[model samples]
Target: MNLGTIGIWSLAFTHGDRGEAREAAAELEDLGYGTLWLGGSPGGNPSGDLATAADVLDATDRVTVATGCVSIWEQPAARLAAAYHALPAHQRARLLVGLGVSHAECIDRYRRPYAALVGYLDELDAASPPLPASARIVGAHGPRMTRLGAARTLGVHPYLVDVGHTVRARSDLDTTSLLATEQTVILSTDPEAARHQARTMLAPYLGLANYREAWLRIGFEPHDLAHGGSDRLIDALFAHGTPEEIAARITKHTAAGADHIALQVVTAHRTLFARTAWRELAAALC
Candidate 1:
């Protein structure tokens, strides 16, 4: 779908009021982001995710809208396909559906995730108006799933990852697969302040085994993953410094073979609007 080299990933679009969300989406498009990725996993009900994507589509003229990932266990393949087909052709063309087999800790039905994902893809293919493999991407981390994503779907969208993982994932993927990675950025110059913000955003992820395993696979020691993540781990996963420094960190991902980098700006206030950060980053990176 030509998601461009840079995009903005935000959870606010999923949870915010429609009017405000639309305004933010429009501003992001005006700022020249190629895609707006709605962050946070969609729960058992897929309606919210679809509606959010629709809102962004309605508000923006050209930028693509994607679900950072909708869990396969939560949202069935049939219903998701139906929703995708219902969209107008232009909207469908711009929409990228990112699917994931959620963590074992979050879903009771998380057994044989790779097999289940294959079955889900089978269902999608069987739908009346099929959801084409090119229209979707998989949220994959490990080599096996990453390879599966390359073979079965558009490519892999690895979340909470560093450039090192991007290098490894690129090596694992087929030449045709798209490699999109998410990077969290905290725009504070103070070392302690920046790390504090990074630690706050990273604490919950440290508890998720999926993310921990991905870190270990990329050469992180146990100590580096503990106590809200060591400085080394946080530095690797997040770009925290001036705008120029953050821009440099993002370039590393592009050099490591990431086709797209979905940048999420971290702020101390969860309710703060990120258009300002988006504008600054667009000036620096776009």
Candidate 2:
């Protein structure tokens, strides 16, 4: 729903103190970001993602607030729909629900992920206050799921991806579907320091099958995924160096056919560094 060219994606806004999260959301809006994406997968609690979206929506006036992704396994489709309908029409219009099937390792009964996602969408469609496909996005990586996203939902929101995957995703989806990609950034000039921070954030992803397979398809070698990823892999997956450098990297994604880029600034202390990174990035990109 009009997620601008660039948006801030961070778990800090969803999992942090309410006062601080509200303050940060307002500040990002003031700084000219088009959307505020609440990162992190929601638990079984029905209100978890909705509460975070509400907090950010209440804090900012024009900026859209989206769940970078809510795991379908975590929250039921009916419950998610109920929560969406519960919001005032005005607020509901500004919120975008991004649903994901999550990883097999994380989910207990992760069989037939594609079928499960289709089933979840079916439930949403059958609900009393149906959650329109136009108002939601799917976390898709593979071709089949990407096609499903285009056919059933707004579009695909591919995470931990490079420009190559962005281009591929654009080709897979119809012109009407959106191609929103998540980009991790580290604002550090030192090569070693930036790689260290990038590796820390990437280590968990390397172990995830979906991410590793995606990386390989995008031209990464097997060794590139080992030992927390090679320098080439880190460099391609993350945008690091000066604000200008990071901005340039973002341009590559947009040039490759990405409609929107959700920028997640990597840091050891998320609460302390997120706003600071956003301020610097806004200056360079906004």
Candidate 3:
């Protein structure tokens, strides 16, 4: 995998205009972000996911475009593999297919999450897609998927997790496998203001069991996830401080065994505003 030190993970296309997202992609590439990661959310359609990757791939020269995850239920993995393989050679090399068994509550059609993911990967493999194993990733948290990540793909893409989870995730994968984790960041210098913004952004995730379990494993209690999120929980989940402090938090994930950190800046505004934060973050991290 050619995953560099850091990547910008965004839901901009999911929530904002595509043109704005494309512009942000170009700007991030200019700012030296190595990859652009697009994630699948509940009730999201992944035609947008492919389009987001295409827009970023078209806008930038060297930066990779990744689906931080496209749920197995959302689309056939074979079709996704075909789309990835059909991109220009350079784009194909720069494109990463990230797969995941999404939230149980959201998957109405699939009865077995694990089985669906396994079948999806099997279909992709049977297709003999152009991308190599190194060019694919999986959204994994618990041990079963973590081991499957090692056996089936490049590595794991864990979300809303801390350094402790990174440590365990790294130990589960082969040393060469990519261990990429998403870290939420807030650029404000005021702790109270930052956590306030982080809480608003993180509220939905705090209720999701997948993320709640990960947080609990890192020592947060159920009560910590309540009422926005406890100070300690917000502080642990989001890197809220000066730009330098935020960069340190992202780098800590790397030191804790993450090969690349995909950053999601918790902001109250638009893609360009978020891109500004990304610029500062890239400068500090790179």
For candidate 1, the TM-score is 0.96
Model 2 lDDT per residue over 120-238, tens place: 99999999899899889998988999999999999998988888899899999999999889999999999899999999988777777877887898889999998889999998888
Ranked by lDDT from best down, the candidates are 1, 2, 3
lDDT by candidate, in order shown: 0.87, 0.86, 0.78
Q: How many backbone clashes does candidate 2 have?
A: 0
Q: List model 3 lDDT by residue over 56-174, tens digit each.
A: 78888888888867777877766777777777877777888888777766666757766777777778778765346677888998878888888888888998887888988888888
lDDT of 3 at 225: 83
TM-score of each: 0.96, 0.96, 0.92
- Candidate 1 per-residue lDDT over residues 154-265, each given as its tens digit: 9999998988999999999988899999999988899888888899988877877888999999999999988888989988999988889988998899999999999999
- Whichever of 1 and 3 has more TM-score, that candidate is 1
Worst 10 residues of 1 by lDDT: 40-49
Find the candidate with the highest lDDT and give its number: 1
Q: Where does model 3 exceed 4 Å of error?
A: 45-49, 128-131, 269-273
Report how far off residue 209 is in candidate 2 (Å).
1.1
lDDT of 3: 0.78
